[model samples]
Each structure stands twice: as structure tokens, then as C-alpha cells.
Target chain A: MSELEIAGCSKYYKKNGEPMCALAETDLHVKNGRFVSIIGPSGCGKSTLFNIIAGLIRPSGGHVLLDGKDITQESGHVGYMLQKDLLLPWRSILDNVIIGLEIRGVSKKQARERALPMLKNYGLGGFEYDHPDALSGGMRQRAGLIRTLLYDKDVILLDEPFGALDAQTRMQMQNWLLDIWKDFKKTVLFVTHDIDEAIYLSDEIHVFTHRPGRIKATIEVDLPRPRSEKTLMNDRFLTLKKELLLMLREEQVSSN
Target chain B: MSDQLKDNEPFIEDPSVRTTKLRRRAFVGQVLVGVIILFLWEFLTRLGWLDSYYWSSPSTIVRTGWKAITQGTLLQDLAYTSGSTILGFVSGTAAGYILGLSFWWSELYSRIFEPYMIAFNAIPKLALAPVLVIMFGIGFDSKVVLAFLMTIIVAAIAACSGVQSVDRDLEKMLVSLGAKRRHVFMKVVVPTTIPWIVSILKINISLALAGTIVGEFISSRQGIGRMILYAGQVLNIDLVWVGVVALSLLSIVMYLGTVWLEHVLMKGRAPKS
Candidate 1:
């Protein structure tokens, strides 16, 4: 059974008196332990899809199943990372990471115990007592990631997690994410407009159309595992990049 | 990021030394300004250019202050005023926070009571002191009630706005983490509202003190306000100036103490600027 299943998912917003569909008749299935990337132009409802899967928003139509259980209405089971770091400035790095555990009724001692290993593993050791205001953008984002991971959820939703970073920092974070994913082995649904990132990090890329977003095509990346920036030079990588660009460009042309 | 504080930077190079320097500079400036003003005032009064009856010289006021302190009258009156201020502040803040949270949690309560609360606050609280004295009598009860009446409105308004100002994104974050309504309030809402509440408390301190003094002015046997009233009636200009100076000092000290406590409570969430 698939880890996540969505059937006939549709969302609409009313502007004035008309119905504006965000996701129309969208259907997709994510297998367990898969790194899936949803790529599209701006305003393509990719974030809407993330919000739906993360149970942050209720779908106007259809249902979602997680691990063979209906979890369309259930919240707190799936972890979501937003574009902004959203780290509470009043909390220390360690306290921020342990927020999820604290919400789940874990004692301070127990939560710290669980969080300490993650902090050390993530190279945030010794800075745990420092406030979020004291940290750099990259460090803050890392803390946000660990915060979601502390929830112990099987699936993680990332919405343009690196979109706010500069080019160099984005590249660095992409590799960092790949390294963390290798160790943690959690299913990741990453949303991004950067086609190179989607191709570099995801096992399968789902190309979405504009406005009323729909899956134009699903292209599997048969590239070798443990990918790096050097892998972008491979012929297959270039070919996949060309195909995704074409699909995105064609969708833009059609929409215009 | 951790290394941001390690360098020999100007303001942050030696945090302790820099903070002490800043404090000392401020103290020096204040003293210089005070001395210059007193010199000018003394010159004017000696030349008979200013009314000495209404505005006594700084030295005369200081002598009166020393006398009051020596006789323990100043301390007694200060204690009485401080007692009423503290009692009213605590009770008013508590009632305001509870009501504000309830308004946030329940729309029914907000709709039913918000208008009445606004109207109550709109009425000048000083005008109600006489009525309060009549109802609660010319004792501590009237003074405490008057102070509470003056302070609680500001607290409730600030807290309600603070609750409404909670970041919606953070609210969603909490909700997705399986935080129930109460947990959301206790953990997210309350903590987020604390800075706002503390700011309101700072403002309410002055209002509460004003209310206490007003109550004493209308009807009271003892208190700093009563002493000032008696001094003014008898044309004891120096004693009146002493009372004014003492009240100003007390207010300044209380305000600074509240701010210091705020810093301690919000150590982690230091403002960037």
C-alpha cells in the first residue's frame, strides 16, 4: 500500500462571484520512503498540495490516506516546513527544536534528551543555548528542520524550504538535505520552483501546470543515488532538465 | 553565528564595560541638566523675576525633603501609596488577562461584553472617585478600588489587542502539532502576549498611582496625596515641591524596576534593534 494516496483532490477560491480552482481533479500517490518533488511555475497550487497533505488545509473535494489509514482530517501527524524559518525568537535553538515534542506532552528532560542527539548530529552542538536572533539564516533554517523532525512523523512536507536562501546557501542546503535524508530515511515531499534542485534531490519529479495546477507529467529520475552538484553534468541529468524546462515553458505558453 | 559576539567590537566588545559606560553617561547628562536648571531658577527667584511663592527654589525643596525623611512622615506616606498601588496593580492585571483571554476564546462573551467594557473605560475614572469613596468609604477599599478601576481598562484593551495580534502562521504551526485550544493559549498565545502585557503594565503603573492619589485627594486621612494637598492649602511651597519631587522619584524607580523585570522575563527574545 502506498504511504500517501490522494483521489480527486480539488480546491477552489471564490473571487467576487466566480469559482477559481487551485487544484482541479488532482490525483497522485506517493509510495513509502520516496523523495518526491513537485515543480511548477509560481501560483501553480504546489503549496496548496503541500498544505493538503500536511493537513494544514481541508480539501473541498476528495480524501487523503496515509499509511493505509484515512488521515484527511487528522492534523499533527505530518510535519511541514515552510518558506520562512518561523523560528520563535524568544526560544533558544534547542528549545525551538524541542517545541514539537513539548506539544506532544513530552517532559522537558525527555524532550531535551531526544533533541540533543539531533542537534549534535546536525552540527548545532554547543549553540543550543543561543537565541534564534543570534543565529544565521542557514542555522535558523536547520533548527526549523530539526523542529519538524522531532515530531517523529513518517512523512515531511517541505514548501520552498530553500527559496529564501541565496544561491550559494541554497546549494549548500540542498546537499545538506540530501545528507540528512540519507541518514534519517524519512519520506520527503519537497516543493520548489528550482528545477535543478528538484532533479538533483528527488527520485521522481511531478511537473505541475499553472493557475489551476494539474500534474502535466511525472518523470522518474533514473540517475544514480547519493547525487551531488557534479552529477548535474551527466547526460541523463541534462536530458531530464531539458524535458522539465520544456514542459514548464509549454505550460506557461498555453496559460498566456 | 556564535562567533558574532566574540570579536573586539565597539558596543559589544566588552558587554559589561559598555553597559556601565552607557549608564554613567546618562547619569552625568541628567545631573548636568538638573544643575543648570536649578542655577537658572535660583537666579530668577533671587532677582524677583519669578514667583517664589508658587515655584520654590530647588535648595528649599531639598531641605524640605530632608526634613520629611528625617521625621519618617515621607516614608509612611510613601508606604501607604505603594501598598495601594501594588494591590490594585495585581488585581487589575489578573482580571484584565482573564477577561481578555476569555474574549479571545469565546466570541459570545466578546460580543456581549465588549461594548459595555469600552463604555466603562470611556467614562473618566477620576470622575468616579467620589462615588467610589461614597460606596467603599474613605478607607483603603476606596483607594484600591479607584486604582483598580483606572488600571484594569488599559490592561484589558492591550491584552485583547495582543491576543488578536498573535501570528496566524504560528497559530497554524501549533494547531498542526496537535495543540489543543488551551494549550495554544497557555504556550503560544500567552507567551507571545507577555511582551505586550508587560508594556501595558508599565503604562498602568502610572495610571494606578494617579488613581490612588485622586482617591486620597477626594477623601483620605493619610497618603502622599493628602500631604501634598495639605501643603498646598497652607501655602507651604517648599513642602509641596518636596512632595512633587518625591512622587516623581517614586514613579521613575517603579517604572525602571518593571522594565528590569521585563528584561529578565524576556531574556531569550531580545529585540533585534
Candidate 2:
């Protein structure tokens, strides 16, 4: 069964008394425990789609379903991580991580207990008590990821989580994310403009067209498991990269 | 080993050490300047370059202050003024913050009241002293009401901006994570507003004090303001100087107290060295 399904979902905004379509009618289905990614140009409605999926905003039409139940216009069902780390500066790392649990009415002590081992596992062990400002950019993103995971949602939406990291850190985070996703087996919808990142991490890649976005293509990533830095040099990886790059280049040119 | 030690010495001038050295120099400079000015004042008065009766030397002010202290009037007046200022500050800040939060929560309400709030803030609060004195009859409550009028507008504006400027992405993240409205408020909104609230509290201390003194000036049987007014009437320049010094010391103490509270609350979040 699909963990999440968006059936004919669309969004439009009224601007200066004229309606502007942000997202065209779109349909998506993510099988349980699979990783999916969406890639598009800058002005594309990728974020709008994510916002609707996360239930932060309502779709102009159609329905969103989780396990066959309509959940359109309802929030707090999925975990979301934005491009920015968004860690509360006032909170220590441990406190920030447990915010989701706290919102669910878990006791602080209990939330701390649940969050400690995850922090230690995520390479933020000793730094749990440190403020967000003390962390490196990559570490701050790690803290944000942990906070999202602690929410324990079945479907997680990652909107370019490594978009701001240095190249080396971004590669490292991609590997770390795969490791965690493999272990947890939670359904994931990742969004990025990086073709290499999408190819490296996703089981399926959804390519989006520019504004009033619609699914341009859905390509299956048939790369073998236990993918790593070595996979970047693989013949298959190069071929897939070329294919995605050409598609995206065409889209960018046409949009202009 | 000696060469290595010498090389390490340059790197040893870390920010903390530099800050301490700079702070110590600043303290010395401040004290030196103060001493020089006081000495010049005394010398000029003694040499008849300035009228002692009008300008009262530092020694004479100190003597008057000591006499007031011994007579118990200084302590009593200090307590009265401090008490009113504290009461007014606490209540005004609390009310202002609550109102600001409500305004943020309801956009329509804020729109309706924005013009009125701005108008009230624009008028000098000291102008209301006579009215407050009339209504409260020159008691402690009158001074507190004046202080409240002086402080509430600033506190409300600060808090309202703080709430409005909280990161939109952070709020979205919280909402996506199954957080309720209350959770978003406690975790995102309140913590974001804290620094603004602390800063306003520090500013409101001086404003509250100013309001209280003005109220006292218009009509009050006690307080440092009254002390200064009485000394001025009798032409006792030393006593007036003593009252001014005491008020300055009181403001410094209150400001320092607010700074300490901010340090404690902010903890690791304080700006890096």
C-alpha cells in the first residue's frame, strides 16, 4: 500500500485580483518505506507541493491521502525539515531535538532520555548541551535532522536538507542520511535542485517543471544498495547524471 | 623551549584576556577622569573662581549625604522611590507583554487599536502626572500609575515586533511536526521574544524611574525627587547635589540588576566572546 498519495492536487493564489497558478494538477504515490526525491528549477513550485503535502497549506483542489485516509488541510501528520536548519538559537541541542516530543506532551525528562542516544548516534553526543550558534553549519543541520526524526512520523519531508552545506559536508550528509533511512525504513520525500544528491539518495526521482509545476518525469534509480562515494564514479551513475542534467537543462531553457 | 614559549605568547592574547585588559584600563581611566574633575571642582571653589554657595564642592555634598544618612531620611526616601519604581516596572512590563502577545495573536484587534496605541505613546507620559496625582491623590499608587503609563508602550512595541519577526520557517517546521498552537507559542514564539523583552525591561527601568520622580516632583510627601525639590527650595546646594548623586546611584544599581538577569536568562545564547 502507498504510504502517501496526492491525487490531482493543485494550488492557485490570487494576486492583484488575478489568479496565479502555483501548482498544476499533480498526482504522486510513495510506496511504504521508500525514498523519493523531487528536483526542479529555482522558481518551480517544489516548495509549494511540499507545503501542501506537509499540510501547512491547503491544496486548491483534490485530496491528500495517508494509508487511504484523506488528510488534506490537516497538519502535524508528517515530519518536515526545511533548507535552513531552523534550530531555535535559544535552545540547547538536546532541548531543540526534544521539541517535537514536548509538543506531543511528553515529559521533558522522558523526551531527554529518548533523545540522548539519538544525539550520540548522530555525532552530536557531547555537544547536546551546546547552543546552536556553537555548532558548525553541518552540525546544525544534523541537529535539525534529529529534531525532525524525533517526531517519529511515518512520512518525512526533507526540503533540500543539505542545500547549504559545503560540497564535502553535503556528500558526507548524503551517506549519513542513507544509513539512517535504511535503518528506519520510513517513507521519505526529499526535495533538491542537486541532481547528484537526488541520484545518490533516492529510490525514485520526480522531476518538476517550472512555475505552475507538474511532474515532468519520474525516473527509477536502480543503483544497488550500500551505495557510497565509490558509486559516484560508477558507469551507471554517470549515465543517470547525464540523463537528469539534460532534462533539467531543457526545462531551465524553456522556462526562460 | 624558550623560542617556542615566545612564539606561543602572541597566540596567548585570546579574546578573553584582551577583553579583561581593556576593561581594566577603561575602569582606571574612568576613575582617573572622575577624580580629576572632582579635584578641579574643589580647587576652583576654594580659589573663589566659582561660587561655593551655588556650586557646592564634592566634599560638601558628601557631608550633606552623610548627615542625611545618619538622620535616616536618605534611606527612607531611597526605599520609597525604589519600591514604587519596582512595582510600576513589574506590573507595566507584565501587562504590556500580555497585550503585545494578544495583539500578535489577533491581527484584526491590533489593526483596530494601532492608531490609539501610537497616539498614546506619542504624548509625553509626564504630561499625565497632574491627572494621575488628582485621581490617586499623591500616594504610592499615583507614582506607579505614572510609571506604568511611561513604560507600557515601549514594552508592548518591542514584544509585538519580536513576535512578528520570529522565523517563519521555524514556525512551519513546528506545525509540520504535529505541534499544536500552544506548542508553537511556547517553543518558538516565547523564546524568540525573550531577548526583546529583556532589553525592554532594562530600558523600562530608567523610564519607570523617570515617571516616578516626575510624579514625586508634582506632588508627593516622600522619595528622592521630593528630597531634591525640598533642598532646592531651601537653597542648600550641597543637599541638592547629594540627592542627584543618590538618584544616579539608584539608576545604576537597577540597570546593573537588569543586565545580570539578562545574563542569567540568556546563558549559552549570549553573544560569543
Candidate 3:
């Protein structure tokens, strides 16, 4: 029911008064309740495609369909999270977490009632009334993830959501994300530059080439469920990582 | 540990307590300086080193102020100054804040008015006091208008900068949550800019008071400024000092009141760190 499709999407920019292609025509599909990741180099149009998919930018040519309905240039069909967690500084954690519901016209009391359990369950129980600055980096990210979930949309777009976290915290957050993803049964489209992170968290990873970016390969990660640090040591995990590294290396070397 | 403690025994004050002690000493030193200056001025006048006619002694000034307070309509004058200041401050700030934030609604409107706002900010508003007095008349309306003029541009500029510096990510997050334009302004734009607006409040109050006093000075029959102007014209030096002291005290009280207002607005809203 929550499938997302990006059909023939492309983006162009004018540089020095000359039209330049940033993202070539690309198509992407995420079936119901699947975890998909987009990985590419720094200058590639991954973010351009990401913004187009989020409907934050209008593509030069393409259509984004959600659940078989055309939603191109129409935002609010999915929840979006960025690298920096944008919790309002003045709002208490409880209030910040419930902002999605608040914006969607839910009564404050009812939003609070619904958010209370999630906050308590997600290691944020005692900090319900504290401001955003009171929380550590990882805790704030958790709060942001909860906010995204509570938006009540089945499709969630996480653009380097854990990119800013330290290594240890990033691993823990990935496990936490997987647990939540399983429990909620939501479709997630994750964008990141880290191959290890993409392999660990995603069911499928789409690799993009440099500049005028388009998908170069779509690899399905076939690993055991309830994965742990041991999974990273597995031969399959190592093999997939090598394959992704080689693909990305080609782009990086070519651009250089 | 014992050796370390002994090494540090020359200065055992805790950090926070040391700061408090230093602040108390600063306050005491300020009061001592004021008292010493006032005593010297009064003593020099009485000893004829300074002429009593030209340089009024503190005691004479106090006596003149007491006489004015009990017998003259000094309270009414105080009330008049206070009224115009308050009316101008509230009206100007509210109107300017709303106008500045409204710039978010349309790019065209913001672009057109931004240069005009900068131009207005560059002009010395007090120079327009006489003209404002002429248009609004030499009554309460004139004083109120001058005060309003003094505060409006500053508040508008502050609010405009606040709106401009609003985090794009916050706005994007809100939009993604299905928030309308007005909702983003109200929830994200306004709250994020509150600190900026409040940071200007202290400056605005002082400017508003200056505007009211200048209006009073120009052509008013009432207010402390009027009393001071009239006393100076008539060479009533002691009365002039009385008016000066009264105005100083009045402004200090109003400044404290503004501080309290800022506290109320920013309570629990400041960043925890």
C-alpha cells in the first residue's frame, strides 16, 4: 500500500549562464514496507534526486507516484528527516516530538496522549519536559526519528539521518532504526555515502555514478535477520562491501 | 590532596561565590562614587568655591523637588510622560513586528520595503521631532508619535533579521509535516525570532523615552522635560537639577520594568545551555 515510484526523474541547473544537467533521467521503485538506500559520491546528484523525491524541488522532467497516485511536486506524502535534527529549541521534548501531529491538526491533548508512550518506550521517558539542547546528539536523533514516524505516513525519507553521529552511536542507531522499521512496517528511503551503513540498514542499495548522476547498480543485500556486529564479519557482508567499494571507487577515480 | 589544598589556601573562594563577591564590591563602589560626587558638589557650592546661583547644591535641589512634588502638578507631569512612552512603545513595536514578519508572506513585498526600511534606520529619528510635533500637535499626540517613531524602525529591523535568519531546515521540516504557510510563520518563524525581538526591547524602551522627552522639550506644557526646559529658561538652577533627578529616577524605573517584561516573554524559552 505504501509503494513509491520515481519515473524518469531528472534535474538541470544553469551554471555561468549555461544549462547543465545535474541528474540524468532515472527511475526508482520501493515496494510496500521495503528499506531502500541511495549511495553515491559527494558531487553526484544524490541530494538533487533526494530533494526531487521529497518534492522539495521540481524536477526538469519526471513523475513521482506514491501508492499509484501521482504525487510529483506535491509534498507531505512522506515524512522527511535530515542530517541535523531540527527540534524547535524552545519546545520541550514532548512538544517537539508531537509537532508533526500538531501540524496535521491534532488536538494538543490528544497528541500528547499519543506521544507519551513512544517517548517513554524510546529511551526518552524522563526527558519529556526538557528542551532540545538538554538531550545528547544520539537522543536528539532518536527524538527526530520518532517525530518522523509519528507523521503517520507510511513512506519516510531519511537523508543522512545518522551521518553526523559518531561511529559507536551510529551503529546503535542503525539497530534501533531496524527495530522500529520492523515494528512499524513502514517504507524507508535512506540516502547516505557510507557503504557499511547502507549495507547494514537497507534491504536494497542503489549506487549512483558521478555528476549528471544516474543509478549504476541496484544490489539486494542478502543477510540474516536480527543482524549484529557478527553480520559485519560474515563473508557475504564483506563480499558485498567489496563490490560496492569497487563500484564507488570507479566513480571517484573517474571524477578525479 | 592536603598539599594541593594548602597550595591553594592563598585564595580559597569558590568560583561562583567569587563572582558574586566581585559584583557586590562593584555595586558598593558605584554607590560610594555617587555619594562622594554629590557630597563634593554640595560642599563646594556651600563654601562658595562654586556659585550657588549657577551650580545648585544637592540639598537645594532635593528641597525644590520636594516642593514641586507636594504642591505642583509634578505627578500629573510624570503620568503624562509615562503614558506617551508606554503607548508609543506598545503600538510601535507591535505594528512593526507584525509588518516585518508579514514580509515572509511575499517575496515581492519584502524586496520593495527592505531598502526603505534601511533608509529609515539611517535617518536620525529625533531630528524629526519638531516636524512630528507640528503635525501631531504639541499635546499628548505629538509625544506619542515621536516615541512611536523612535521605536518602530528598530523593532521592524530586528524582526526582519529574525525572519531572515530562521533555519531553512526547520521550515522544510514543517512544510514536510503538512504545515501551511501561516502555520510555519506562527510556529517556527515567530518563536525562533523571539530572542531577536526581545533583544531589541531594552533599546526600544530607551529610545521611546527619549522620543517622549524630546517631544516634551520641544513644545509641551506638561512632563518632566517641560519642567526642565522652563527651569533652564528662567535660570532656576535648583529646579533644573530637580527635574533632571526626577527624570533619571523615572527612566531607571521604566528600564527595570522593561527588564521584567523581557523576562516574562523569554521565561522557559531561552536555550538550556
Candidate 4:
């Protein structure tokens, strides 16, 4: 039931009194429970496309349809996360996790009751009452992800959620994310410039082209799920990585 | 580090313990410096090396202070000055804070009023003491009004910066979670700005005191300012020194109280030691 569609989306920004193209006409569709990744070179407007879908910004030239409804320039239909955890330093980890619930009128007591178990089930068990500064970077990022998930949105848009982590932690987070995605059955649209990350996590990887980004290629990874570290060394995985790498390199050169 | 620890093992004092010791030593040194200055003044005056008529000695100052405390209107003057300062600071900061927070509700409103606020802030509030005393009259109200004038603009400016420094990305995060405009303000803007508002409390306290003193000097019959002014006119050097000492002690107490309040307001948010 959680399907998303972007129809003829385009974005424009005013730079020095001139209308500059940020995202060209674009169309994207994600069926229920599918995992999609958007990857491209720097300044290729991957984030612009991401924001348009998240409804944080308007597309200027098209509409964003979520669950078959026009949601262009609107927010709150989906959960969003960025590379930085953005946790309020004052609030406890448990409280931070339930911010969205509180915003939607959930009583504090009820929110705490619901979040306690989730916090325990995740690795943040006894650390619930501690402030964000007490947690490691990976733990903080995990808390951020939990916050996004607990928001209970049908679609989640993550813009480089693990981009700030070290290579080892990023690998662990990728596997952890897959488990959560499979268990929750929620549609996810992830954006990253890391080709390996794109191929490892997404069911379909949307490769974006140079500045004024448009979908350059859509590569479908048919590898079996319950994906693990072993999947990273698979022949198909390497092939997809090589292919995405080539496309992104072409875009990066043109952009520079 | 205990005496029981063997001296042969080079003792490493705990960091917190070392910090406490250093702070204690600094306080002792500060008090020692004050004692030396007072002792020298008293000794010099008794030896006739310093003129007692022009430069009152510590002993004379203390005697005058004690006499004023026990018989004169010292307590009443203390209450009046401190009352106006606290009243002015609280009211001015609250009013300006609310006014500044309202700006977040409308961009047009903030932009339209920004220049006016800046212009108002530029005026020396102390210079308006005579006008305020005339407007509010030579009573507690005049002193309170002056103190209010001194603090209001500064509080408003602090709050405006707090509003501007709000994390837009955090606002976006809240919006993505189905939060509305007021929700973003309460959940995001207010908590984020609390630190900013609290930071100005220390500054506003001193400003409020200055305004109160200035207003009292301009017209009021009470307050430490009036007491000092009367003593200067009458050539009561000891009383003037007593008034100066009392004011210093008063301001120190007020400043420490503000630090405590700031600590309380930031209870959960204060950075870990």
C-alpha cells in the first residue's frame, strides 16, 4: 500500500538573478516495500530530487504522488533522515527517539511506554536515559534511524544516513538496515554517492547524470535477500558496482 | 589523596579534587588581597600618612556601615535598590523575550521591526534617567522604569539572535514528522533558544542595577545611589565609602544568583563536566 510516484519532476534555483537548473524532468516509481537508491556525482542534484520526493521542497515543474495522492511541496507523508543525526543534545536518547510521536499528539507517558521496548530491542537498551553525547557516533546514528522508523511513515527517505560513519561501521549499518527493511516491509528511498552502498542496499539503483540531474540508468540487483557481508563479494555485486562506478565517473568528469 | 597513602608512590590527585583545591586557594588569595588593602588603608590613616577627611579608612567605613545598618535607613535603601533592579530585569527581559519570539511567527513583522529595535538599542538607556524619572516620578516606579529601559533592548536582541540561530534542518525534520507551524516553534525553536535567552541573564542583571542606580541618582529619595549622593554633598566621606562597599557586595550577590538561575534553567542541557 506504500507506493510512491514522481511525475515529470524538475527543480530550478535562482543564482545571480538567473534561473539555474538543479534537477531536470524526472520520473520515478517505487512499489510497495521496494528499496531504491539514488546515486550520482557531486552537484548532480541527487539531494534536490531527494528533497522533492520528501516534500521538503517543491519540484517547480511536476508533482510528487504518494499513495496515489498529490503531495508536491508538502511534508509529513514520509520520514526523512540526513547524514548528521540532528538529535537534540538536551533530550535523553529515549526522548529523542519519540519526538515524532510527541509532535503528532502522543502523550509523553504513552510515547515513553512505546519507545522503551524499541530502545531495549535495539542496542540502546540501558542507554535510553543518557544524552546523545554519551553515545558513540554509530550508536547516535542508530538512534536517529530508530527515530525515523518510529515515526511510523510508510515511506522513508534517507539522504546518506551512514555517509558520516567509518567504513567498518557503514558496512555493519548496511546489514542492520537490510534486516530492519525486511522486517518492517516499508518502502525506502536512499541517496548516496558510494556505489558499493547503492548496490549493497537497494533493490533498484537509480544512477543520476551530471549537473541538472536526470536518471542516467536504473540497475536492478536481483541478488537474493537476507543479504550479508558475503553478498559484497558476489560476482553480480562487483558487476553492478563496476557499472555504477563507470556511470558516476562519467557524470563527475562532465560536472567538473 | 589521603595521608594514609605511602609517600614513596608519587601521588596523583584526582582531577576533580585538584580543581576544588585550586578554586579554594584562589578564593583564599582573593580574600587575602582585600584584607591587605584594607589593613594598609587603616594603618596609613591612623599614622596620619593618609588624610582621614578625604580618604576614609576601613575602620571608619566599617563603623559608618554598622551604624547605618543598626540605626539609619540602610536596610530600607538596600531593599529599594535591589527591588527595583530585580523587578526591572525580570519584567524587561520577559517583555522583550516574548516580543522577539513573536517575530518568528511572521517574517514580514520581524523585518519591519528589526531596524526600529536596532535604533532603540543604540540609545544609551542611562541618558534617559532624567526623562524616565520625570515620566514615572521620583519613586520606586522611576527606578524600575529606568532599569527596565536598560535591559529590554538587550534581551530583545539576544532573543532575536536565538530565533535566527534556530536550526532550519531541525525544523525541516519536525515538519517531516507531521508537525505544524506552532509545533515547530514549541518543539524546535523554543528549546533551541532557551540557552540563548538564559545567557543574557547575567548581562541584564548588571544593566538593570546600573539603570536603578542612575535613576536613584537622578531623583529618587531612597536607594544606595541616593544615600551615596547625599553623603557626598554633606562631605560624609565614611558614609560614601560605606555605600560603595555595600553596592559592591550587593552586585556580587546578584551576579552569583544569576549564575545559579542560569544553571537551573539549563539543568538537563548543560554540557557534561
DockQ of each: 0.51, 0.68, 0.65, 0.65
Per-model CA lDDT versus the true structure: 0.86, 0.90, 0.90, 0.89
Expressed as tens digits, the lDDT of each residue in B125-173 for candidate 2 is 8997999899998889999998888889888888888888888888888
Docking class of 2: medium
Which lDDT tens digits does candidate 4 get at residues A191-250?
998988888898999988888889988999898887888998999899888887888777
The residue-by-residue lDDT of candidate 1 on A149-224, one tens digit each, is: 8988878889999998898988888888998888888888899999999999999999999989989899999999
Residue B14, candidate 2: C-alpha displacement in angstroms: 4.3
What's the best-to-worst order under lDDT? 3, 2, 4, 1
Residue A148, model 2: Cα distance from true site in angstroms: 1.0
- What lDDT score is found at residue B104 in candidate 1? 76
Interface DockQ of candidate 1: 0.51
- Model 4: how far is B72 from its true place, Å? 1.1
What CAPRI-style quality would you assign to candidate 4? medium
Clashing pairs in 1: none
**Per-residue lDDT of A87 in model 3:** 93
Which wins on DockQ, candidate 1 or candidate 3? Answer: 3
* Per-residue error (Å), model 2, residue A52: 0.7
Docking quality of model 3: it rates as medium
Per-residue lDDT value at A242 in model 2: 97
Every model's TM-score:
0.91, 0.95, 0.94, 0.95
